[model samples]
Target: MAETSPIAIICGGGPFPFSVADAALRTGRKVHLMPIEGWADRDRVAAYPHDWVPVGQYGRMVRVARNAGARDIVFIGTLVRPSLKDIRLDWKTIKILPRIYRAFRGGDDHLLRNIGKIFEDDGFRMLGAHEVAPEILAPAGDAGRVRPSAQDIVDAKLGLAVLDAMGPFDVGQAVVVTDNVVLAVEAAEGTDRMLQRIAALRRDGRIKVSAGRGVLVKAAKPTQDRRFDLPSIGPTTIANVKEAGLAGIAVRAGEVIVAEFTAVTEAADTANLFVTGLAPSSPP
Candidate 1:
């Protein structure tokens, strides 16, 4: 019965692709994977019906999705931007160089939305990973055993406000706060690096902020493309939060992907860290 629903997945990198595939399979949905070579987890992707393709091979991706009879396609995980010199463009891809070049210069959102337009032009509806794996989505509150303190809650709200303001610039999805003071905002450096900066500040004592004095809040940017760039958190993120001495982690409810929810929460429990799913915010 569930086998009747077939979807194509365009995966980039990380545990998310596997997580999505696993959840989809359990519901009896057939998953056709088109993973970027080198970036994708080869062994994990192999467990499902998969085709390996290079990041720049847009033409091949479309053909594979079409062959899979995919009416709907979902893109997941992180794709590290490759150097210009590293790309190997096919003739089909080269023909679209003008659009691709503009996308490349305009930043990730531009690049992704352009890619989305191409896929849409090819007649495939783009779907969010949550549509395929609802279990991966963050629940409405107190996601882990520990709960955020009142101050932590305040910081979380402020972080969201700041994050909202930053969105239009395509700034970032996550922000760090301490006693209502903004510590860091995720940029091109990514969440991990942003958190590491906070950790470094703690070590430097130049900021006079101590460890465990802050909150880490992540949510989708107001203008974020939901089909991709859904904020994700996992065991590694939990470990980073713990190491950063952040009081807790907060993400928008129903929007974030809490990868390996059980494992992440259990780890949060062990680390005495709180993980909460707050309501999503609208743009300012």
Candidate 2:
């Protein structure tokens, strides 16, 4: 039934939104994109049937999706949480202001889950990008020509442990570790900026570890709603890891999203950095 019905995709920044759309199309599902203004790539969205939506225009989004005969919705790509005052609320959003205010009081996972519930209450099914395109999920083992060393694998395990421990706090998903020492943890700054911070630290001689000694490990929160905000990696992530002087990158296999898999692999190879997907139970 879903295969025949059009799917509504709420796009954010980066290439994942288009990647999901392409994958859905290949499976014979029609897609109507609702690109969030300011965040989504305008040029890329022009290639598909898309409607431009502002951050707080919930009513407009629903009408557009319903008009396109879409019942399933997928939220993909990156978006920094917006301040409530910054949102230009439509009547529908304004009507639900109390709920929205409460949602904003918590962390990102809490906020997204609540907002998704709002849409669900209004008659729509929320789906993860991975559900629409399983091919985008990271596979087990090495993802490039370079392989992680024993030390790198150990560090990845430690990084995963840190993320798992921090999951309940609703903190960020990615972390950098070297020689069992936690170098950095992703917070409100997001992964790329976090990596840039590490790079800056290295440049200032704060981190004495030689280049290519640490690992960047990413995974979803343990109790996170998979329908939204699954951890993701792309070629840009590879570039950031390299700049941070990391030897490789590791993510939970079949759990994290891998955008542009071919390009990610090529970037990893070209950078001489390992990009491996660790099994749910163990590091790869």
Candidate 3:
């Protein structure tokens, strides 16, 4: 008797999906991938047993996963919101459009929870990246020589307060703070662009600091659906933080995903930047 593979991957944006696949493979499951078109890397996803589906083809995604012999499904990476007009939804998917549209009108958490329900109703359990790769959750200590100063810690708490307030609106998960002032808040542009804004502000002298005491704080929103869109950071985030002249980064402990954990920590150590996973603080 042959045992079924425990999981199939529904891959979207970023390197985390690939990391999920890697982790699943390490655990001896035959990790099949359902790569969403426009969001997943076809060349990379093709390395696994896969079916490529368009982002809006919810019906096809489930059928393919069932066909792949996956008992449970793992979802990893980002899916950018597309204009409704751009989606060429199939008949089965079109029927569910109203629900999706309403979800979108509400917030990201609502949209994703609805999407997860769609998969579950089709008999697949969608697991978080953290569940897929618990080893990749960033550990709860500074990962480099540079540690957040007392002021940086205060600023991180402040940023976390802001993130919590904005989370219910499905706004963003990150904020940059320095010298007890917020340098930037993540918006629709995401973390990278938000950090770039800080860099730009410094370049244009909008921020007074010549060097960098920037601390980036990333965490789950107050209403975050942890099973799907848990916050993540990796080597790229470290590089970007360095480029933005940020001294360190803090994330919600046991909630944030750290893709390429070893490489991210090594890079942070090399750059003398700190990455810490801490419990969220109350708004003070």
Largest lDDT belongs to which candidate?
Answer: 2
Relative to the true structure, candidate 3 has a C-alpha RMSD (angstroms) of 2.3
1 versus 2: better TM-score goes to: 2
RMSD of each candidate relative to the true structure? 2.0, 1.2, 2.3
Name the runs in model 2 displaced over 4 angstroms: none
lDDT of 3 at 54: 87
Q: Model 3 Cα displacement at 191 (Å)?
A: 0.3
- Give per-candidate clash totals: 1, 0, 0
Estimate, for each residue in 1-284, the C-alpha lDDT of model 2 and write its tens digit. Answer: 55678999999999999999999999899999999999999999999999999999999999999999999999998999999999989999999999999999989999999999999999999999999999999999998899999999999999999999999999999999999999999999999999999999999999999998999999999999998999999989999999999999989998899989999999999999999998897833
Model 3 off-target regions past 4 Å? 1-4, 280-284
Q: Which window of ten consecutive residues has the lowest lDDT sum in model 2? A: 275-284
- lDDT tens digits by residue: candidate 3, 1-284: 53346578888888888888888888777887888888998778777888888878887877787787886888788887787888879887898888778867866677788888877877788788777678878677776666878877888888888888888788888899887788888877888878888878778888887565879999888777888777778888888898889888988777788887888889988988888777544442
Residue 183 error, candidate 2, Å? 0.3
Deviation in angstroms for 102 in model 2?
Answer: 0.8
* C-alpha TM-score for every candidate: 0.94, 0.98, 0.93
Candidate 2 residue 94 Cα shift, in angstroms, is 0.5
Query: After best superposition, candidate 1 residue 170: deviation in angstroms?
Result: 0.7
